[model samples]
Target: MILSVALSASLALTGSPAHAATKPVTFQGFTIQVPIQWHAKKEGVNLRVITGVCSPQAAECQSFLLGGPQAVKYASEGGPYRPDQPYHPSSGVTECVPVKKYNSGQATRVRTSKAVFGAGQRARFTEWKVSCDGSELNVASYTQRVWYVKAKKVIVVDHWKTPGLGGILAKAVWS
Candidate 1:
């Protein structure tokens, strides 16, 4: 009985083996565990988590972004990004492809659902698809996922499709 209790305590403290390689990342009043290799950087009023390869010239590299009310208010081409609205991170032509002269068109919402974060905190989750335009039309495409907590005015934007990120966010803890 004593051994079982001790093991239970250990499990509670360290989590499962799958989480052994993760580290807690805090933003605003929320925290989530992400792979230890992921690097977090502060960008303006937002926090960006670098998950994969990135380009120095790309406006948005392969990573995710965490933002507060201020960042959300001006997230889209200096406009607001409401939960019910479409996502438009930038205006005019923006670089979607790392290669030179490749640009991206508008982003359209493809899927949306209710998501949970930070100890059952509810959020609006959405996926947007954008097409890359270069020498040929619709050369390539990418998906951008977003989770918005309206009451808290917090948002998580992921464009790189980082594995297990959604599950990590679902298990977040709020402070």
Candidate 2:
């Protein structure tokens, strides 16, 4: 019985993660609806799904961050920061995930995000980036995200920033 119980516990952890929460919380000015797993902190939140992690697949993470809420440069020597030339460290990134680019045109729609159609209001796969004052990005960021409504809930999930995978928290969704 003990062995069986241990196996079950392991399955719960290793098995497929539970779908995210589907509630919208209004902070500052913007309204964001996300899953429960994507817990909201004082700043932003964190969620995970079939996206990139800190282990690998970080190359694709760059294309997601269009910019930041602030008027700062991204891949250059300036305000927030710039990519390290050699042996880049992953300590800078604070929060990294996809965001909802509501006003994005069709041109960026194809590359910036992914759509998940559903019965009711479809959850838009948006990129979520960290910011200083809902303007300038602080650290790392995510490339993209998958947003969808499951069981009448809007949830957003993606890869957790890890080593090698790097941090990507720029051009986030905000008010």
Candidate 3:
């Protein structure tokens, strides 16, 4: 009995069950592999809708928003939609970053670079660190991967200090 218990504990600790295959979750016209145990939900308007997902214990969920090139219609300086912007990876970071962070204080765009996702699709990747006002113990940080596919669509992948999720986005598959 002790041996069985130890074996079970080891399996749980090693997360052998969590290594099962990950199914692809589709949002808008794009699809990406959501890591095991992550949850996804779609919200917002047709062109502005985003399928967001996060680990159960995560503080913030990541948003997967994809739209046609003409979907740049920003309702406000920080609204989730941008109808005036072009199709670029950086554009996704600009539109997807919450406006409240900017309104609170200065948010830094820490880094930006090029990336590839899903069958060699090129994209723009960016990272941000937001320093809020006051003595708040927690601050906001984000990493975004944007893909402007030849289909004339823009795909934005947003995460908050969550590692590996971006890697899943990097392996996204378009249908």
> What is the overall TM-score of model 3 with all chains considered together?
0.56
TM-score, model 2 to reference: 0.24
Alpha-carbon TM-score of each model against the true structure: 0.80, 0.24, 0.56
Q: What residue runs in model 1 are displaced by over 4 Å at the alpha carbon?
A: 1-17, 56-59, 97-100
Model 2 misses residue 125 by how many Å?
9.9
Where does the lowest 10-residue lDDT sum fall in candidate 1?
Answer: 92-101
lDDT of 2 by residue, 1-175 (tens): 9998998898777663343334554432334444433333331232222222233423223221212222112212233222212111133433323333311111122223434332223333444332212444443333333333333333333333332111112212344
Off by over 4 Å in 2: 1-21, 43-175
- What tens-digit string does per-residue lDDT give for candidate 3 at 29-119? 5677665455555444322222354445343344445444333333225343332222232322332244244323344566666666676
lDDT string, candidate 1, 1-175, tens digits? 9999999999999887685687888999998888887889998878999887777756566788899988778767778886655455566566674443467765678999998886859989998887666357647677778998888889898877778888888998999
* Candidate 1 TM-score, C-alpha based: 0.80
Give every collision pair in model 1. Answer: none
